[model samples]
Each structure stands twice: as C-alpha cells, then as structure tokens.
Target: MLAIRLLAEPERLDTLALPVRPARGEESRPEPVSVTTALPAGVVEEVAALVPATRLTGAPGETYAHLRPGRTPGRLLLVGTGDGDEAAWRRAGAALARAARDETYITFALPDDASPAAVRGLVEGLLLASYRFRLTDAGPTPSLTDVDLVVADPATHADAVEAARTTGRMTALARDLTNMPSSVKNPQWFAEQVRAAAADLPDLTLRVREPADLAAEGFGGILAVGAGSVNGPRLVELDWHPAGATTHVVLVGKGITFDTGGISIKPVPAMKLMRKDMAGAAAVVGATLGAAALRLPVRVTTLAPLAENMVSGSAFRPGDVVRHYGGVTSETTNSDAEGRLVLADALAYAVRELKPDLLVDLATLTGANAVALGKRHGALYSENDGLAADVLAAVDAAGEAAWRMPLPADYVEYLGSDLADLHSSPDRGAGSVTAALYLREFTGDLRDRWLHIDMSAPSWADGDDAELTGGATGWGVRSLLRWLATLR
Candidate 1:
C-alpha cells in the first residue's frame, strides 16, 4: 500500500512531477496542458517546456518524462487527463504511478478543478495501478512507498481524502483475496479471513455456517456444489448496522473458490482462471468492511456461500435436482453454471431472514455476460427501473463501468424444467439474463427490490493496463460502497 499524505503546497523538494494534457489526435503527438495550476508558478511552465508540444499528445496512459539538469536531478512526468472527468483523472493518476513505479518517493498535485470525490478517484487509480500480487516473490518488491498528494486546500478536502484512502485499502484487500490460488484459498480459509476482518470492525457481526450447519439449515445449493471437493462448503454472513439506520441493504456474493465446471467440465484453458470465480464474494466483503470503516449510516448485510466445484464421483451432476434454502428446486443443466446455484441459497436466505429493503447479488456467473458486455463492464440486470437508476448512478459516481441489461419476463421460460421448479439455462443465448431470472425465483415477492450484477468480466483483468495492473480488479467494491453512502 502507498502511504498517501496531503500537501498544501509544493515545497523546494526534488519530486516526480505530474502535469496533465488533453488527448491528442490520431496523427499527432500529444500536446498536454498543465492541470497542475496549484503547483508553484514556474514549475508547471518549466516542466511543459521540457517536452516538445507536438511530440506527445495528452492522451490517457500517454507518458513523457525528462530529467532536469541540476545538483539534485528531478524527474518530470507529464500524463494525459483526456476529458478531465473522474475516469480521465484516474487514468492520469494510474499512468503517472506506473511511470514512477521504481521511485522510492513520488509527489503529484491534483488538478485545480478536481472535487473531493474526484480526488478520491485519482488516489484509487494510482493505488490500483501500482498493485502487484507478490505473495510468492515472483516479482520485484514495490519501490514506491511514500506518496505526497499535492492539494491546494488540504483542510477542506481532508474528509474526502480519508474516505478515498479507506476505499482504496478495502479494494486492495479484495483484490488480494481474489488473486489467491485455489490451493490456498478454500472455503475454510475464506471464512477465517472474514472472521478476522469482522473481529476488528466494531459494528460488524460475523457468522459462519459449516457443512453440518449448512445441511441442518437446508442450504442444499451450497452443499451440492461442494460435494466433490475435499474441502467442505461454508456460508458466511456479515452484518453492519449503525445507530438510527432505517434502510437495510443485503449483498449476496457467489463464492466458488475454484470452479472446475464439475462433471460438465470446461476446456483446459478456461479452467485456468477459475481461481478468481470467488471475486464476487471478495467484493461484497470489501464493501461491507469499507462501509463499517467509513461509518456509513446504513445497515449492510453480506452473505457469501463459499464452495469449490470440482469433478468427482461425489460431485453433483447434470439432471440432478437440488432444493435450495426456500425449497426452490433447480435442475442442473450445466455444472459450470454453479455460481448461480450457490448464490441461489444465499439470496433465498437473505430474503427470508434479513428481509432487506434492497437486495443486490454479484456473481461471475456466465461467459455469456462477458460476451455481451465485454471485459470492460459488468452486466447489471434489474426489472425495476428505479433500482436500476440508483445503481447506475452509483456506478457513474464510482467510475466503475456497468451496463444495464434487461431481464425480460419472457426469458424466464428459458429456465423451465420438467424435473424441478427451475433449471439452469442450457442454451447459450441470453444466458446471463436467464441466470438472473433463475435467481429471481428465490427472491419471492422481494423481486422488485432485487438487482443482479454479472461481473464475470470486470472482476478480473487479463493484462496490466493504465487503470489496473492485471489480476483481480475489485470491480463491485467501489460501486457498492458508493451506493451505500447515498442511502445515508
């Protein structure tokens, strides 16, 4: 983690400078302008003159650097802030951080027009881009440690800066958990981590149900999914309620530690990235922790049904019917679609017991969703327009991309099964929507307040880029946290 501190002004210290520029044309080099008006008068002009105006356009991720000739040689980094929106600023911060990855200490000033919220986004981008999972020492240690955030009004933006710090920390935690290999991060390990996290949070209460408890409580969906793995299944519930909080929001996450596609096995290549299938659970945990840490004035309950979907004689197979928590029977059409199965039990439990005013479930449920929304955005489905609008607003505010997808009532028939109440979608078309429709059956009358997010794409990244350095992106944490804040 980068140690970030707010600075009222830039002193006479040798630091890496960050100057923003507008995006460049396709044929031209970027000529970036100085968004660092808050920097000392001569610093911006001096840095701008160092790079040729037409040599580099100020495009996002575009970088230009020069070493000033002096007793103390200082590095100047010019980054592009394209449209100067929250996303652009975050990209600019990421580019700058990536460019200065080897530095021991780095300093950059926020743009003058940057709001407190925008400043937070900038910090998040920088931290996210600098992130590297080095648990096994396969990569070099991170050189950049201390970061100085130059702000014109530190006193006024203190609260926002602190909030950004908390959000960034939580996001990183989620990413770390998501990036862990399945060999090390089974259902028990996940439960222990959540327990430890909840112990530190004063307002949060932690509950873990082992395999016996799950069986006794009739969480058949979770049990069936984990029947093949040597490690048993677990259902973890975390609750955070503040004083005088009236609105209750329940977050359910699918916790498939490693998905092998069960008896309906997937291709070898597709199975490689299955370790990140639990990203939804990690996001919900991170969001819950962030809300508690920030002291948000809303009650939040997080439910994660943790399991491993493996191939074995004991594994639940196709044509098998498993009754979920609310006695909703689902016939398995494809075991690879097991994420929704585990989530089915959790959603039903949340609805029956928690009775939240709003219910949102996040899952890496389908490749069809990735095909529909691509890797850059999560697919959000909600029949209720008002709920969709609120979630979209929060997504915009958090700068996490999510496209609203439809849940047509007619598509519910795709999940029809003669053997059970519902069946997992066998067809490839509209698979994401149909999966959501399947889960909706468990919500009972609470369907109006339900929102399903298929985050199969955005939850993990394939390669290092400007905003995120590959691996787990912690996709839903920011949006969930922002949505919770609005409820206050």
Candidate 2:
C-alpha cells in the first residue's frame, strides 16, 4: 500500500503534479493549459512561466514528468484532468503514478474547485494502480513510497480521503486472495484468512462451519462439489450488527478456490485461470469488512461457500442429484458449473435462517455474462425493477461499471429438471440469463429483493486500466460499499 497523506500546507515539495485542461481548439501543437489554483501567490506564476516549454496537451492519462535537480520543485509532472471530472482525475492520477514509478516521493496540488468525489477518485486510481502482488523472493519493488495530496481545506475533505484509502486497502485484500496460487488456496485456507481478517474488526463476528458441521446441517450441494478434493469444504459467516440496526442485508459468494471442472473438465487453457474462481468470495469479504470499518448503519452478514472442484472418482457427476441446505434438489448438468451448486446451498441457508430484507449474491458463475456485458461491466440480475434500479444507481455513484440484465420469466423454463427441483446449469443458449433464474429459486418469498451479480469477466482485468490493476480487479467491493452506504 502507498502512504497517502492529506497535507494542509507542506514546508517542502520536491516533485509536484499540476492538473491541466485541454486547449480551446484543435491545432498541430496545442499550448499548455493555463494554471489555476489557490496555491501560494508565487507558486502558480512559477509553473505558468514554464508552461510554454512543457508543451503538454491535457489528455486523460497523459503526463510530462521530469526531474530538474537543484530546482525549487525538484521535479514537475503535468497531469491532464480532462473535463475536470471524477473519471479524468482518476486517469490523471494513474498516469502520474506510472510516470513517477521510480520516484521516492511526490506532491500533487488538488484542483482549486475539485470536489470531494474527485479527490477520492484520484487517490483510488493512484493506490490501485500502484498495487503489485508478487511472490518471488528477489525482485524490484515499486519505488514510489509515499504521496501527498495538497488540499486547500483538508478538514472538509478528510472523510472522503479516508473513505478512498479504506476502499483501496480493502480492494487490495480481495486482489491478494484472488491472485493466490490454486495449489494452496483451498477451502481451509480461505476460511482461515477470513477469520484472521475479521478479528481486527470490532463488533464483527465470524463463524466457520467445518466439514462435519456442514454434513450435519445437510449442505449436500457444497459437500458434493468438494467430495473429490483432499481439502474438505467450509462455510464462513461474517456478521456486522450495529445496535438498533433495522435493515438486514445478506451476501452470498461462491468460493471455489480452484476449479478443475470435475467430471466435466474444461479445456487446459480455461482450467489455468481457475485460481480466481473464488474472486466472488474475496469480493464479499472485502465489502463486508469495508462496511464494518466505515461503521455503516446497516446490518450485514456474508456467507462464503468454500470448495475446490477437482477431478477424482468420488467427484459429483453430471447426472448426480444433490439436495441443498434448504431441501432444494439440483441435478448437476455441468460439473464445471459448480459455483451455483454451492451458492444454492448458501442462498437457501441465508433465506431460511438469516431472512435478510435484501439478499445479494456475487459469483463468477458463468462465461455467458462476459459475452453479454463484456469485461468492463458486471451483469446484474434482479426480478424487482426497483431493487435493480437502486443497485445500478450505486454502481454509477461508485464509479464502477455494471449493466442490469433482464430476468425474463420465460427463461425459467430452461432450468426444469425431471430428477430434481432445478437444473444446476441449463445448456440453453442464454447461459447467463438461465444462471440468474436458477439462483432466484433459492431466494424463496424474498425473491423480489434479491440481486445476483455475475462478475465473471470483470473480476480479473486483462491489463492495467483506469483504477484497475493487471490481475484481480476486486470488481464488486466498490459497488457493494456504495450500495451499503445508500441504505438508511
């Protein structure tokens, strides 16, 4: 994590990043944008004097970083804040981070009129872009150690700055867990990590269900999926209950630590990417912790069904019919679709026991969602129009990408199973739609308030872009945090 400091007035600033806007009209060579700020009277004029030499166009993610030794400001970085919007600030922050990757320390003066949201977004981009998860014993680490955000009124924007820092730290936790090697990231390891993290959070309780407890409680779906692996399954429950909290939100995440596809094995190429099958689990855990840290006024309980779908003689087969926690039987159609099986048991349990006012589940449940919404956005599914609208609003406010997918009643026909109450995976054309419909079955009478997020593609980024790093993107945490904030 990068050291983030909100400075009211620093005595020294070796390197400075100045925000620039685009020129009025197009030209072969556009001049540097006019500097504007409430900075010291002489400082603005100093930067303005060098604008002609900078020769920088204010494009998002564009930067001119150079260090002039013995100069008052040792290094000057001109960052483009396109349109002076939240997104542009994020891009500018990211560009600055990459450009100054080798620098030890840097100071950036916030725009004179930058809102709290823009400040938060800028820090989020810089922190997330600087994130690096490496396992090797010997390698170069990111040289940029600390960052200073020079603000005019630090007291006014202090809360927003902390919120951004908290979000960045929590998102890093998700990324680290999701990027873990499959060989060691089994059910037990997942449970232990969740427990350790919860210990640091006050008033947040954690309960772990071992294999025996799971068996006694009739978690047939979770057990069936884990039967083949040497590591047995586990269920983690993280609870954040504030005094007099009226609203209850239950979150379920599919924690398939590693997916080998069992009897219905995927191609070698697809199987190689299975380490992040548990991205959903990491996401929910991250969100719950964020809620607890922020001391949000809503009660939150998250259930993570941890399992490893491996190939062995004891593995569940395509025709196997397994009863879930709440007696809903599912006939497994594709062992590769094991996420929904464990999720079914978790969701059923949440509805039967927790009885939350609003229920949401996050999972990398299907590839079809990527085909529909692309990698940038998660596919959201909900039966109730109002709930869907609320979630989409939060996603927009949080600066996360997501699209609302339809839950057409007609798609329920694809999940009919002669041997069981539902089909785990329908081979129908609309795999993502059918998958959402299958999850709706476990929500019981509270189905209208349930939100299903298929974040399969968005959870892992192909490369660094915007606020996302190269590997695990920690997709759902920000959106979940924003939605939780909206409650009450």
Candidate 3:
C-alpha cells in the first residue's frame, strides 16, 4: 500500500521547493508536481519555464522532468497539462501515478483558493489513476513512494481524506485482480484467491461451489463452458450481511478464466487476449473485499460464475442446448457467446438461492459493446429507470466512464428458437442488446431490478503502459462500491 500524508498550510508546498513537503521517516520523495486549472498562474509559468518542452508534452501521460532541491534526496518533476482543464488535470494526475514509485513520496499541492469540490475531485482522480496490481512483488519495487495531499487542516477536511482512502483501496483491489494473467487466475485459483484474501474478515464469508456441487445441482451452463479445462469451473460466493441492513445488493460476475471461444473457436489472433474474459469476476471479488473492509451497513452478496470457455473434444458446441439452473434451456448459437450462458446459471442462483432485492451483473460479454461504446467505457443495461439513474450517478462519481445502453424490447424476437427455449446468440446486429435479452430470460422474475454491465474494453488495454500494465483495469469495483453505499 502507498502511504498518503496530508499537509494543510499553503507555505508547506513552497518551503520544500516541491509539490509536497517532506516529513520525518521518509527518506527520498519524488519532486513530481501535477498542476490543474486549480493551479495558480504564477506557479504554472514558473514550472513551465524550468521543465523541457518534450517533458512538458509527455508529462500529460508518462514523461517527467527532474528538479534539484539542493539537499533534498530526490528531484522535482514539473508535469504539464496543456490548458489545465479538468480532463487535462486528470490526465496529469494519471501520468504522475503511472510514474510514481513505492519508495518515493508524491505531494499534490492544491491551488491556494481551490474549492472543496475541486480538491475532492482531484484526490479521487489521482487515486483512481495511480492504481496498480502489486501482488507478490516478484519484480522490482517502485521508487515513487507516498502520496501527499496539501490541503486545509484535517479538522476541516476529514471527509475528503476518508473518501480518498476508500477510493484508493477500491482502486488497488481492482488493479490487483485485473492484473493477474489467466494462467494463474483460472476458476479454481480465482475462488482460492478470494478465500485467502478475505479469510480474516469475520464479516465476509467466501464459498466455492465446485464441479461436483454444480453438477449435482444441475448448473449445466457453468459446467458446459468449463468442461474444456482440466481445472474445471466454480461458483464463488462472498456474502456480507451487516446487522440492521436496509438494502440487499447482489453482484454477479462472468468469470471465464480463459476463453478460446469454445468449440466455435475464435481466430488465433482474435483469441490472444481471451484471458481477460474473467475481468468481471475480478471486479466483483475486488469490490466485495473492499466493501468488507469499509464495513458498509448494506447487506452485499457477490456471485461469480467462474469458467474457462475453451475448445476441446468435451467442450459444448454450437447447436448444443444447455439446461441452466432456472430450468430454462438455451440453444448455443455461437459457443463464443458463452458468457451469458455461465451467467444465466449464476444469475438464476442469485435470485433463487440468495433472493437479493436488486441484481447487477458485470461481464466482458460482447465485442459489439466495444464497437458501440469504444474503450475507456462500459455499456450499462438496466430494466428500471431508477436503478439506471442511480448506477449512472455512481459510475460518474467513480470517474470510471460508463454509458447507459438500451435493451430493446423488439430484439427479443432475434433470440427466439424452435429447438430450445432460447438462442444464446441472436443475429450480429445489436449484438450487445441481443446478448442481454438471452440473459434476461433467466432473469424474468426480477426484470425491474437487474443491470447488465458490459466491460469488454477497459479489461485489456491495447498499448503497454504503467497505469494499465497492459492487463485488466478492474473496471467495475469502484462503481459497484459507490452504488452500494448509495443504496444505504
């Protein structure tokens, strides 16, 4: 964990000739200073004159300039954000986070007269941008250390600090789970990891419904998708029911450890990054752990359908009809469309077994969503207007972008099948909506209280960078956490 220390006085920033003043027990600190629209004009001009142009431009993303503070063990870094707009400031913050080290300290100097809202926004953006998955520390540790926030006195800013801490922890957990490769985080490993991570939390209970249990219970969707792997599938449940809870929020994630598109088999190049198919599962477990740590009053139940949809002799094939947990049958039109199948059983289990008041399912479900919304955002489909509004607000608050997607009632026709109760994949057009329709069949009992989040893009980045690490972004956890808190 990165240590965050707060300093109040405005003079503290200049006294150290760095963004954040040094404190006792901290040997070396990064001189990296991120400026926003909140930055004073004089400060921006002065820093701009000192740093090189190339560093100035690149500083918006990943470049840094070194500054000498005479006796201070570390160097000062001036980060430029072009016009200093809010988005620019956010990018500048992400750039600093992407450049930070575990050993070096960072201080974000607030503007002299910045509003409380701006300060809060800056801290949230910085924490979200700085997230990384530092699991075993198998590689070199970071030299960029602590995060310092120069603000008003703690007495006046206690709420801001608490909010920052909460968001930071949420981001860290999401990053940790998303960063793992599919090889090390398959269905069984995913369950074991969740158990180990939350073992000491008395408020949390982690349980894995293994292959035997799933088979006996007739969870054909999960078993069919995971049969290709030697590791097998599992339904991981993490429950947190605080005393005197007012709301019951249920989260279902599609945890496909590695997807080879099943027997429908994706092209080799198209299937290379299939490991990230389980990002939705990663988000749920990560959020559950954070919520337990936060000790929220609302009762939270997380259900993850863990599987590896690979191609093998035993793999479920196109035209195969699977009997899900709800007693509904699905004709596999495209084995690549396996996420909804696994989720069908899990969602059914959530409503039938846990009986939560509301349901939200997250999955990297369709390529159509990426084509529809692009990267940096996910598609949110909800049956109820109130839930959609609440969810959109939470996603906005978390700064993890999401757009509300329509689940067209007319597209229900595409999923109709003659041989089975439903078709897993309909026609290619409106593919994302059609996929949601298939999942809705299993969720008919609770249509008004369900949300489907398609997180296909942010789970894997196309480029190599520190903040993203070219792996999972753990996209949905913070949004889910914020949403759950609001429910209470």
Candidate 4:
C-alpha cells in the first residue's frame, strides 16, 4: 500500500514536482507556474531555457521530466493540470504518479488557490492511477511507497485528504475482486471475501445465504442461474445503519462471478473476460465499505446476488420460466441474459423486506449498452428525474461519466411475455433499455424512485487512463459514494 501524506508547509527537497497549467488571461505561451520550490535561481533559469524545446504546454496527462545536474542528482517534473478542474487534476495526478514512479519519496506542489475538493481529486487520481494488481507468489515487491503533497494549508484540507485515501483503498479492493480468476472466485469465494473485508467494520454487518437458504427464500432466478455450477450461489447482504439516519437506500448488484452465459454459452473471445461480470457487485461492496469508513449519516442495505453462469446437465434452458422472490416470473428467452434474472430477485427482496426509501441497482446487464455508449460512460435508466439529476451531479463532481437514458413507457411492451409476467430479453432492438425495464418489474411500486445503472462497459477499462488502471476500473465507487453523501 502507498502512503499519501499531506504536508503543512514546503519541505526542503531534492525532487520537486510543480503543476503547469495552461496560459491564463493576457498570456500566450506556457510557463512554469510559481510554486513552493527549493530550486536555485540558476537551475530555474536552466529549466526556463529548456521549456520551449520540450513543448510541454501543461496538457492534462502530460509530463516533462528533467534531471538537475550537480554533485547530487536532483529530479524535477513539470506536471500538467488542464483548466484546474477536478478531472484535470485527476489527469495531472496520474501523470505525476507515473513520472515519479522510480522515486521512493517525492513531493508535489499544490497551487495556492486549490480547493479541498480539487486536492481530494488529486490524491484519488494519484493513488488509483498508479494502481497495479498482479497475482504472485513472490513476496511484496518494492515500488513507489510514499507521496507527500505540499498544500497551502493542510489543516483546511485534512478531511478531504483522508476521504481520498479511503476512496482509493475501497476502489482498489473492488478492482481486485473483479480481476480475480473465476477458477478461484466462485460464488462462495465472493461471499467469503466480502466477509473478510467487513470484519473490522463493526457498523457494517454481512450475511451470506447459501443455496439452501436461497431455495427456501424462493430465489428461483438465482438458483436457476447457479444450478449448473458446482460451487453453487450466494446472496451476500451488508447493512450499515448509523445513528440518527433517516433515509434508507438499498443497493443491489449483479454478481455473476463468471458468465459463460449458462446453457446458451458465449463465444470463445467473450467468455475470456467473463470474470468481470461481477464488477457491479464489486462496485456496490466498495461503495458500502466506503460509506461505513466515512461514517456517512445514512442507512444503507446492500444486496449482492452471487452466481456462476456455467454450462452443465442441470443448467436452465432458454425456454424455462423462472419464478423470483415475491412470485414474479420471467420467461427466460435467452440464457445469456442472466444478470437481470439474478438482479430481479435481489431487487424484489430489497423492496419487499428492506422497504428502502430509494432503490439503486447496478449490473453488467447488457452488451448493447457498451455498443451504444462505448466504455467511457455508464448507461443510466430511471423514472425518477430527481435521482437521475443527483447521480449526474455526483458523476461530474467525482470526475466519472454517465449518460442518462430514458425508460420509455412504450418499451414496457417489449418485456411482456405469454408464459410469464415478463421476459428477460427483448426479441430484437433496444436490448439495454428492455433489460432496464425488465429489472424495473421487480421493483414493484418503487419504480418511480428506482435507478438502474447498466454499467456493462465502464466496469472494465481497456487501458491505463486518467485515475484508472488497465483491468477492472472500479468505476462506480467514487461516483456512488459522492452521491450517497448528498442524501438527507
């Protein structure tokens, strides 16, 4: 684990990193902004002479590194923070982390006018952007260990800094859960991991329901999906109820530990990445842990339906009609569309038993969402306009992206079925929209206050971008945590 320390005042340092922003009013060319630096006048002049040739205009995610010559070698990095926004700061922090990868300890100079939120964003970006997860038998490898950020007033930004550290830790945990191999991460394994992570947090309580418990509870959707797997299925519930909390929010995540598409099966190329099918569950767990760590004044009940959609003799067929909790049935037209089936059971349970004031569900429910919105944004579907706006606001503040998709009433017809009350997948177009609609059926009368986030694409990052590594991105933790802070 990397240690992120906040410095009250500028400390004497041989290695100094300074933020370089774009030219402001009445300026045409880029220049290194004044910061807390210990560089001598001669060295500063040397850097001035080389700035033009380097073409470092302070673009976000850009860095220029130069070694100062002397009896002792010193390092200098000109990091970019475009427009000084939260997103820009995130990019700048990532670039700085990469630039300083070789050093054991380095100091970053924060602009005097930087706000607490910007400082928090910078810490999160550096922590997550430098993230690398690998399964190895070798003992812990040494790498960049300590980051000391010099801010104008550490006292003013103390809370933000600590919050950023917590956010980064939880997000990394999520990425680790999603990046684990399916061979090791069966439904039972997922439940045990959750248990271990929540052991220290006494305010957070976890309950794991095994296959028999699920069967007695009438979770046909979950049981049918996991019937083919030897590992069976689990419903992991975590509750965080703090003192003086009014609003109750229930979060449901689709935990398809490995999606081979059940009986239908997936193509060879697609099944390779099925390990990330449980990203939604990972994200919810991250958010719940974050809430508990931060001690936010809100009641939260998180439900994760864990299962492995594999192929076997007992696998549910495509034509099967499965009954969920509360007796709602889905005509399983496509075995590949198993996320919604499991989510239906969890959502129905949340509404019937939890009686939450707000319902939010996250799932990698459809590839069509990825096809439509690409990997940069999450597809958000909700009938509650207020909830949509709040989530979008949090997305902006947290530097994540999500586009609001509609829940067209006319599309409800797409979920209609002859054998059951609803069908899992649409016959033709609007796969993502219909998937959201199908999940909405399980929400019962709480449809108006529900939010269905189809995070199919954004859950996995293709490459190392600003504030994210190459594998599981842990995309929802930051945004969801920020949104939860606004409740009540």
TM-score of each: 0.94, 0.95, 0.84, 0.96
lDDT score for candidate 2 against the true structure: 0.87
**lDDT of residue 450 for candidate 1:** 94
Model 3, stretches more than 4 Å misplaced?
9-66, 69-75, 78-90, 98-103, 112-141, 464-469
Please provide, for model 2 over 1-488, each residue's C-alpha lDDT reduced to its tens digit, 9 standing for 90 to 100: 88888877654578877877777666634334443335444556666655557766677778877666876677788787777677777778778888879889888877657788888888888988898988995887779988988777888788888888888888999999999998778999989998888889899999999999999999999999999999999999999999988999998998999999999999999988899999999999999999999999999999999999999988999999999997889998789889999999999999999999999999999989889988888999997898889889888876678888888888788899999988888887888888889989989988988999999999999888877889999888888998999896
Among these predictions, the greatest TM-score belongs to: 4
Candidate 3 or 1, higher TM-score: 1
The Cα RMSD in angstroms, rounded to one decimal, for candidate 3 relative to the true structure is 6.5
Pairs in clash, predicted candidate 2: none
For each candidate, the alpha-carbon lDDT, in order, equals 0.84, 0.87, 0.73, 0.87
Q: After superposition, how far is residue 361 of candidate 3 from its true place, in Å?
A: 0.6
Model 4 misplaced regions, further than 4 Å: 10-12, 36-44, 71-73, 137-142
Candidate 4, residue 273: how far the Cα is off, in Å? 0.2
Lowest lDDT sum, 10 consecutive residues, model 1, at 28-37
- Candidate 2 wrong stretches, greater than 4 Å: 24-46, 49-55
lDDT of 1 at 456: 90
